[model samples]
Target chain A: MIGTWTLFQRESRRFLRVKMQTIVAPALTAILYLIVFRYAMGDRQVPGLDVDYFSFLIPGLMMMAMLQNAFANTSSSMIVGKIMNVHVFLLMSPISAAEAVFAFLAAAVLRALVVGSVLLLVLLPFSDLSLAHIWMILFYGVCGSLIMGSLGLIGGMWSKTFDDMAMVNNFIIMPLTFLSGVFYSVSQLPPFWQAINAWNPFFYLIDGFRHGFIATGDSDPLQAMGAVAILTILAVLSAWYLWRIGWKLKE
Target chain B: MNALEINNLYKVYGNGNVALQDVSLLVPEGSFFALLGPNGAGKSTLINILADTVNASSGSVSLLGHDLFHERAWCKRRMGVVPQEIAFDPFFSPREVLKFSRGMYGQKADDAWVDELLERLELTQHAHKITRQLSGGMRRRLLVAQALVHRPKLVILDEPTAGVDVELRKRLWDFMRELNAAGTTILLTTHYLEEAEELCDQVAIIDQGKLITSRPMKELIREVASSSLCLRYAEPLQLSDEDKSILSAFSPRVYDNQLCLTLNKQDSRSDFDTVYQAAKQRFGTPVDVSIRQEDLEDVFLRLTGDSS
Candidate 1:
């Protein structure tokens, strides 16, 4: 447990030491997203929902920040350590693979929470959001971050270079998050696209998180939570399996 | 008890490249041992396997009486490794690095011990500076300090002085000697034969992924029973066909204006005396004469078959 905490502290310090890039830059980007989408389509309302577009956008943006920051935290740390050969320090230590994996996940989730909280605070004045079901909010926030953090660990272990990590982020993570109803609801999309969104785990994450804020969702909150839980488990298991096999880690 | 023991260790990579081949070794407790080998002879591979960085295809390794694979956590806690490459997070300072390294071993941070290590490695001045800002030698020293953070019972240093300066190398060896004297087992691999000859009590030579010889340093040196006699003439000696025939049997050749004759252990003083007489009879007189005894370099070359 001490070993895990120490590694957690080290991973946290690594990102916090470069706040301008890790925290400040992402916070600014989230704020910018909020600003651009609000000005472009603030007064509009969804067909059945009564809330303003800006209010609806708030939860999506917050979830987006949480997801992306979580992924970036773990993926960037792993890739940088791999490239620099610094992972050897951890590998040669007495820390078990499970401890190392959990430490990284904990650090990533911590960063995601910080980024999400900051974004929420920054956009609070621009829109009205009800935190009626705080339990759901906390659940989705943590579950969403855990899922993304696990994916980040998988991508980090599979990638051999920074370029490969960028490929995973740009092609896989970015596209999925963008199309997961961040700026608009899935109901506004065509039936075929909505069908596709149903298959994307990110859709459940954003939908569940928004349901936490507004008590409104396109799908059953229970079903969304179930899907997110399953996906998180799969991602975590994949990362653990990779670590156990020493894939691309031990030679 | 042996500090380390390996039984029939073998490492075959996925590409079918055999890195280690049935190699076995033992280092008694409190012994400073040297593992010497030419490039591609599996020295680093053996160290990596012991460090748990690389999994051996087939082998059993015991460190300090604990099975390396079965009781890896225990073995790892009792061993420290300084790999051949410089590996550290550039974002971390030396102080933070050591603290984190100690923490990884489930050890509490001891500021006094960390500071002492920094001072001993001459890295105190750079303790707070980011590792990337440190000089190459300073970075190397920091690596040494990082490996010692947990104060393991057995330390494996793989070419630790490869790029370090002379003064730093001296200090590093001095610290290593002190640690060995204090009962810490030290296993080192170095290209510098003189360094090995000076510091290591026992030496093992490996060639082509096989152990060629393992013995005490003095014994290994003495086992190579070949010497050379070097003669320098006042001027270039013009030799007749008869003198050439006599010197040819001894493989005498002019090197840097000196005639060098290779002599085996069986060759007596009279054999050298005969060569001296022939040289004097042919060249009028010799200006200088010296006998060179076989050293570690000779033994290493002969064992590795790198000698011409």
Candidate 2:
């Protein structure tokens, strides 16, 4: 447990040491997103959410920040350490596989929450968000962070170059984030697009998390929570298994 | 008890490159051992395996009487590794790095120990500086400090002085000697044969991923029974056929008006004496003459076929 905490400490310290890239940059980007969307689509309401566009958009954007930051935290750290060979400390440490995986995920979740909080704080005055259901908000935020952080770790292990990491960011994570009803409501989409969104697990993450803020969601909150919970365990377990087997990490 | 014992260790990388091949070694407790090898001879691979950075394809490594593969956590807590590469995290200061390493090694935080390590390694002045602000030698010293932070029973140092200066090297060795005297087993790999000859009592040579020889330092040096006579003059010696014939017996080579002649085999006293008289007769009153006994460098080159 001490080992895990130490690793977690190092991870958070690493991110905190570079606040510009890890925290401030994401916060700035979120603020910019709000400004641009609010001006471009002034005073609009979602087709079915019946909520002001900014109010509906705030929680979704927070979830986006949560997911992206969580993913970026672990992926960037892993890839940089692997490339620079400083990960020798990690490999040579006595920390167990579970401990290592949990540390990375824990730090990721911590960063995600931090970035999400900053977004919420900055965007609060602009929207009429209820900020309801605090339990659901914390639950979905943590779940999303864990899942994205796990993916990031796995991707980092699989990547050999920054370009490879970018491929994941550009082709997969970006597409998923933008297409997951983050800026608009899923009910407004056509049947085919809705079906496609149903397949994207990210949509469930955003819907469940947004429902926490406004009690408005396209899917059953209970079902989405269950799916996210299972995915979180599976993702974290996959990370642990990789570390245990020394997959592209040890040798 | 042996500090570390490996039996039939073999590692074939994922790309089918064999890094280690049936290599076995024993490092007795409190012994200063050297694992000498040329480049690409699997020295780093072996050390990495012990450090748990590289997994052995097949082998059993007993570290501090614990099975490394079965009780890795136990082994890791008792061993520290100084790898060949110079890698440090840019985010952390030297002090944080040491604290983090101690924690990673399953040791409680000890500021006194950390302070002692910093002062010993001459890194106290740079403890709060970010890693990027440190010089190469300073970074290397920090690596040494990090490896020693946990005060492990066995420490593996892989070419720790590769780029360090003469002064730091001296200080580093003194610190290492102190650790060794305190009963900490040390496993070292170095290209500097003279340093190895001076420090290590047990020597092992690996070439082309196979152990060529492992022996006591004295015994290994004794096996290469050879000597060289070096002759120098104010003017280069112009050798005729007769001079060539007499000097050829010693396999002479000239460099900057100096003649270095080697007697390949040293066991025969009469042979050396006869050649000495012949060379003396051929080159009369040379400016200076000196003989050097064969050392570890000669033994290493000869046994490894001088492949490096």
Candidate 3:
């Protein structure tokens, strides 16, 4: 357990060391999403709601930052390990697969939290978003981060090249996050797109996170929790399986 | 009990490349065993198997009498591995690296020992610098220092001095010899046959994933030390074609200023003097003759020839 925590601590130190890349960059990207959504639809109001566009987009932006950074943390770390061949240092020790998985997942969650915190801080002055349920906000934020981070671990383990990793990020993760109601609500979409959004896991994460900022949309908090929980469980299991198989790790 | 034992180890890659085949060797307690092989000769694979970084398809590896696959943590605690690759996170200082390695091995942090390792490896000056900031040679020494942080009973170094300079290489061999003297069994895999010849008590040569030979250094070298004598004369020697042909039967060669001969068991000291006297009398100038013993490279070439 101490070994696991030490690994986590080492990763956290690395996170702090590269704050410009890990923290500032994601927060900057989130701020860009805010500016674009605010400018394009500032005066526009939803069909049955009075919320401003910036206010509505804040939670989604936070969730996006949380998810992307979480994924980036694990994937980038592992890819760097591969490129530098520094992974032998970790493997030559007595650290187990379980410990490695937890440490990486924990680091991913921490990176997500840092970026999410920065996003929330930067948006507080510009938007009228309120904190309705802080617990829901915290739970979904961490859960979403874990899910993405674990997926990143799986991607990193599966990737033999940087291009392979970019494919997962650009094609799979980007498309899912974009179509999961980041810029718009699923209710406004047609039936086909609505069903696709319903199946998208990011939809629940953003919907749950939005519940914390506003009094809500997209789904019930109970359903949101269940969705994110299932996705997190599945992602964790896959990451653990990859580690067990020593996918690209032992070879 | 042997400090390390490998029995019929085997590894076959998915593509059917046999990285190791029935490879077996033992490092007795407090022995400095050298595993010598050329590139792609399964040396790294053997080291990886013992380090538990790579799995074997068959046979077994035991460290300190504990099964490597079953008692991984227990065996790992007693073993240290300095892998061939110079690997270190650029984010960490040498001190942090040592601390982390020690902690990972389930050993309590001992600043004194860590300091000693740093001092011994001459990494104290750069102990606080991130790995990326250090010079290449310093990084190599840190690899050695990192492996020693846990005070493991067995230290396995896989080409630790491959890129290092002569001074650092000698320093490592001296440090390793001291460690062996202190009861830590050392296993080294290297391409430097001369280094192995000088440093290792027991040597094993592997070829094409198989253990070609394993024997004590002195015994192996002595068994293969076919002596050679080279004669250098002050004046050119003229001989008939038939006489030159007769000299060629002794495996003799004339080049530059010398005549070389393959010293055989049948050639006695009197025979050497007679040949020298005859060459001097024929050339009308005294001939200088010398004999030298064969080294490990000769033995390695003879045993594992240039097949692959």
Of candidates 3 and 2, the better by DockQ: 2
CA-based DockQ, model 1: 0.77
> How much is B105 displaced in model 2, in angstroms?
1.3
- Full-model lDDT, candidate 2: 0.88
Tell how far residue A100 is off in model 3, in angstroms: 0.8
RMSD of 3: 5.0
Per-residue lDDT of model 2, residues B59-154, tens digit only = 899987889999999898888899899989888899999999988877789999999999999999999999989999999999899889999999
Runs off by more than 4 Å, candidate 3 = A48-50, B229-291
lDDT values, one for every candidate: 0.86, 0.88, 0.82
TM-scores for all predictions: 0.92, 0.91, 0.89
lDDT of 3 by residue, B22-118 (tens): 9888889888999987789999988887876687899988887888888887888788899888888888899999998888777777999999999
Across A1-251, the per-residue lDDT of candidate 1 in tens digits comes to: 77899999999998899989888888898788878887898588866677778888888888998999999988998899899888888889988878888999899899988888888888787777788678888888898888888889889888999999999999999999988988887888899998988898888888888888988877787877777788788888788778877778899
Clashing residue pairs in candidate 2 (N, C-alpha, C atoms within 3 angstroms):
none
Q: Is candidate 1 or candidate 2 better by TM-score?
A: 1
User: What is the docking quality class of candidate 1?
Assistant: medium
Question: Judged by DockQ, which candidate is best?
Answer: 1
**Can you give the lDDT of residue A135 in candidate 1?**
83
